[model samples]
Target: MTRRPATPLPPLEERRRLREAGSLTPDQLAARLGVAIGTVRAWESGRTTPRGRNREAYAKLLAALAESPTRTGAPGSAPAGGPEEPDAAVVAVGPAKTVSGGRRGRAAAKPSAFTQTPPPSSPFLPFLPFSPFSPRVPSWAPPEEEDPLGPVSDLTPVQAFDALYSFCAPSLVRQAYLLTGRRGLARESVERAFQLAWERWPEVARDPDPAGWVRAAAHEWALSPWHRFRPRHRRPEPPLSDASDRALLKVVLRLPPSYRRALLLHDGVGLGLPDTAAETEASTPATAGRLLHARRAIAARLPELSDPRVLHRRLAELASTEPLRTAGPPAARDGCERRARFWTRFALAFVAVLLGTTALSLRTPPAGHEPSVPPGETVRDVPPRVAPGPLSEKQRKLRAKLREELLHGPERLAPQPR
Candidate 1:
């Protein structure tokens, strides 16, 4: 018998090259393909063969190893060829293990880093769209009007008097002076609060009580970085001509931030203790206590100012001269209100059109038949009353046969007895 020429083996040659270069271990190659180490050894020794996808995987693995130092052996490593050594000699060098088919563990599990997550509901939250940071878009509609109660929110040491002075106008200047004991501080605080409201107009609109939000924002602003550096008193302050007003200022200024805040809320601005507490994020009882203490301190500090006539005359004079800042030019005041009204009208018109279109569609008669009932009638609400047409030839024939049989049989006998 003639012996065939020995077949050339490419896979066995590549496997032997990889081992010589130290790109992969025998156990690693076997584990990657979920095969026993003996199978990889056999392929390298040229005693058995790698088939189909295994051959493809082996080619890819070698290519990946050759290209990257991070993946394979470090840079300047040995190449995979050493043809002079026999394949059988390589297998003999390693220890043997008996193979068993069983469950695989942690080492064999595939990595799972590619999972996805659910996205948040609203793109805008905690931060609103129309904050001070948002760009201003000009509208042909109008200028934004200040809300009547807008000035009522957070009043800092300076702002408390400002809201009273500014809202009350020139007439209430003395009353405002009485409240702050410093007219200049009061005016500045009022102006700052207005600017604050303008900056956060969009957020303010969304708030349940815009005035409350403005008040809270103003309070935070008072404790802000800018406030800390500014001198307690500045030049060109408003003049408090009344001696009692001058004296009252000294007494109020001596109190702590909390006590002063409580007094300002109750007497100057007319906010009750509970409302003040809510705005300040304090309990009602605590706010009440603070208010009581603040009042007592003021009375003790200025016995003359505490008298009914002295205090009343000052506030009354201020009220008379100073009109509340709530009134402004009609054009300037209608900006936001006009925009709101326009959008509301647009929405109502859109809904009406939609409803009309739907009604028309429902009432439309189908082609090839006249409507059972005409449009713009009560019949639209009720179902169409269908009239029965004449029967077909087959039905007519069956009805005729049944009628003849009934008349010739039972009915015919009953008629004879009558």
Candidate 2:
């Protein structure tokens, strides 16, 4: 295969050719190239041409598309540069079939564990119409039917966690960018949050507020094992349009850890005094006071944030750049189930042991239940006046007199209070 010379077609023609090839949509190409959708549109409209690095990137995109047959409509043929497709073979995915119980027989092919059915094509793409993936959603917005499961209303807790993240991840990423000022840090935290949420989906889904849980998880993740104890720089956001906002964020990143935490817990998470305090394990009043001071300090350094419009705009911008990392909670419900099974087995064994011991004890007669008492021993309910010890001579004489009197048919005694 011969490599073609770099064809510097006019911007409009180049964009048209890329679109005609059916390799990628303008938006997909733009995203892959890290350029704005509008930029692609402008190029297609002959409004502009890519220069330097962008030109190289565009060339690479075209080359990749040319090499990938499926991406570029090669009609059931392998890509130009890729290896040949393997011969067809049965791909089993379900339980293996067995013939007879008494005699061994051939096992049937089974379905694979990893196969996923792609969603059917529809005009709708989950949430919104134009930009299927955009930020700034109402906190209580529900998911759409176009999603893999059709709707979130019927989804299980684990599924809910995933659906919500797919919808909310973009905004969360943007928020990170706004709060941290470092785009990379913002991306890292949001991705970490998504990954962790996926890992503990069962528990998180069971939670009343899974998204909030992910938010908190992400916030803490930024200060991970590598950077937990490090002195963090503050990221101050100035007015959205003001270029100075970037510079101001650098200063915010320099704040002391406590001050930064207080400010971020309040502003970044939109947490109130009580919630922020609870998350930080501080008193509500203390948290409020600290937040007030932190905000004041940030304002003192970056006065632009004091403007309400600027602050709101910056927040909105941050909300748009949510970083998406590994998606979904890790599937670990099996671990929980195993633990539950262990406890259940242990309890059953313990109960059996206890019952066995009880039965053995019941089989033996209690010493106290014996009919006869040993010599010199006394039973609790026996009358004290009926002394078992050696009787005094007077008592013995009285006893003998009583017996004689009884024999004579008359005997009298004074009553005592005892």
Work out the TM-score per prediction.
0.32, 0.37
Regions of model 1 farther than 4 Å from truth? 1-185, 215-228, 231-239, 304-418
Task: Write down the lDDT of every candidate, Cα atoms only.
Answer: 0.44, 0.50
Among all windows of 10 consecutive residues in model 2, the one with the lowest summed lDDT is: 86-95
RMSD of each: 41.7, 23.1
Q: After superposition, how far is residue 266 of candidate 2 from its true place, in Å?
A: 2.9
lDDT of residue 149 for candidate 2 = 20
Highest lDDT scorer? 2
